[model samples]
Target: MVTPVRVVIALCLFVPFVAMLWVGSYAKTDPAFIGIPFFYWYQMAWVLISTALTMIAYQLWRRDQRGRSSRKGGVAE
Candidate 1:
């Protein structure tokens, strides 16, 4: 049974991958941020965002595992 939490975690992982893959979307320089070009800053921002998303995914995964384990009487297998 797939849970909604798992779906949200999957989206968290998928969005960054898709965003980074679609390079042309942020390949411009007009929308500069803090003096950094769009191309450079966008990727850098995604780096931070990716780190956060990964942390969220890890925590969610751990919580899901714990839930499953408890449901099975805390058996480790």
Candidate 2:
């Protein structure tokens, strides 16, 4: 009963956690963006990315809950 949409939602939530956890991957500062060092800028950028991904996951979770509730003849909580 797991759907493709749910799989995509899980990926959206999982990817950012893995990316932020893998600090060594973006530890260098050679590639500065607009004068911001890679180390600082990279983490800052993920703050925004994480927020967006969380929002996406929330929306998708809501949709999935609605679907499940409808199938059970109950209102989504």
Candidate 3:
């Protein structure tokens, strides 16, 4: 019983993994930020991005769980 909300949650969780693992995409120094190399800055940026994504996924999961429980006539925990 896959739902659009669930798919969005999955994407939120998966995007960071793909972005970090795809090193070739950020493995360079041409785009420096405040003297920090692209490789370094990119990884740091992803850290923040990953945290945001995780938070979003967590919220969506909680919302989905609440919806499921309510539909079953159970109180959300």
Could you give the candidate ranking by lDDT, starting with the highest? 3, 2, 1
**TM-score for candidate 2, residues paired by index:** 0.87
- The residue ranges of model 2 lying beyond 4 angstroms of the native Cα positions read none
Candidate 2 lDDT tens digits, 1-77: 78988998989999998998998999899799999999999899999999999899889999899989999999888
Q: Flag regions of model 1 displaced more than 4 Å.
A: none
Model 2 poorest 10 in a row by lDDT: 1-10
Model 3 segments beyond 4 Å from truth? 75-77
Candidate 2 or 3, higher lDDT?
A: 3
Put down candidate 3 lDDT per residue, 1-77, tens digits, no spaces.
89999999999999999999998999999788999999999999999999999999999999999999989999877
Please give the lDDT score at residue 8 for candidate 3.
98
User: Who wins the TM-score comparison?
Assistant: 3
Better of 1 and 3 by TM-score: 3
* Residue 16, model 1, lDDT: 98
* Model 3 lowest lDDT segment of ten: 68-77
lDDT of 3 at 2: 96
C-alpha local distance difference test of each model:
0.91, 0.92, 0.94
Reference-based lDDT, residue 20, model 1: 98
